[model samples]
Target: MEAIYIDKHYNLVVECKQGSRKACYELYRLYSKAMLNVAFRIVGNIGEAEDVLQEAFLDAFNKLKDFRQETTFGLWLKQIVVNRSINLLRKRRLELIELEGDHLENIPEEESEDEDDVQYQVAVVKEGIKELPDGYRVVLSLYLLEGYDHEEISQILNISENTSRTQFLRAKRKLMEILKRKGPAS
Candidate 1:
């Protein structure tokens, strides 16, 4: 049995496929902000994110006929946005280093901080993410913020699963350092 996705905007999507400009606009209006946020998180620049958002919408509209609707339109658009954002990052020469098999196991683990003991403001956390290297930031955002696991991230970023896991681990440590330096929210 196939799982059916209950999309409330199915009518709008059908209308969009039929070339209804109003329906297309409505779909864009309904999804743009969330899609833009997805793009922004991956691309890490508002201007580039906006550019990606436009390109993603254009791509989605152009490919509307190919949409099978197995998932909600929002999820489809998000995939497009994420792909575009990653492409933009690639064009900017984002590099994800691959780790050797044994290197991961050899790295000494740092003492884990009790995250519940400290409070961080949203803006500060965002700033710390921005401060991370492109590879770390992308992996962290995709894994933590975008909810993709290391295996999915490996496929999405074209790296080994071990590499993805290593990047995520390093990103977490770096983010924690940044947050600690920023201190608890006052």
Candidate 2:
């Protein structure tokens, strides 16, 4: 078997768009893990994440002609993965809310807390996030872990930006409640 050395992913994309199955498969092999990670973070289930990954790759491959090389191929593919994951969440009929008032100003700034304490708190929060309902989990992961703004999240999830903001806030409050219930470890 000849090794397909893909130096630039866009090159592979160009080849794949030209109907090279090998190049397309190689593209999938190169990006599947990272894409899967993004999907898993959004969907919060191994099986569903895998489904999203497969769907994302298929969509990316089919839509390769639309790729303009402005961003790295991996980033473009990751966006597809994220969109697929969000779509899956929406298909589950999650109730997303748009904030009506000026609640964005109320979001607290990160305080200068101790590094170790922050790490511990983040770990605890992550555990709590895993316990969240699928709807909250997806929005929370996208906003917090993936660093998406409400506008980006709204576009991704097909909800209003205010809804994204509101879900994120509620998710945070729920996570904090869970952490409080867990209490300090001995």
State residue 114's C-alpha deviation in candidate 2, in Å: 9.0
For residue 185, give model 2's deviation from the true position in Å.
4.2
Candidate 1: C-alpha RMSD to true structure equals 3.6
TM-score attained by model 1: 0.88
Q: Cα deviation in Å at residue 99, candidate 2? A: 4.5
Q: What overall lDDT, based on C-alpha atoms, would model 2 receive against the true structure?
A: 0.81
Clash list (residue pairs), candidate 1: none
TM-score of each: 0.88, 0.79
Candidate 2's C-alpha runs over 4 A off are 1-8, 102-123
Pairs of residues at least 3 apart in sequence or in different chains that clash in candidate 2: 97-163, 98-162, 98-163, 99-162
Cα deviation at 78, candidate 2, in Å, is 1.5
True-vs-predicted CA distance for residue 75, candidate 1, Å: 0.5
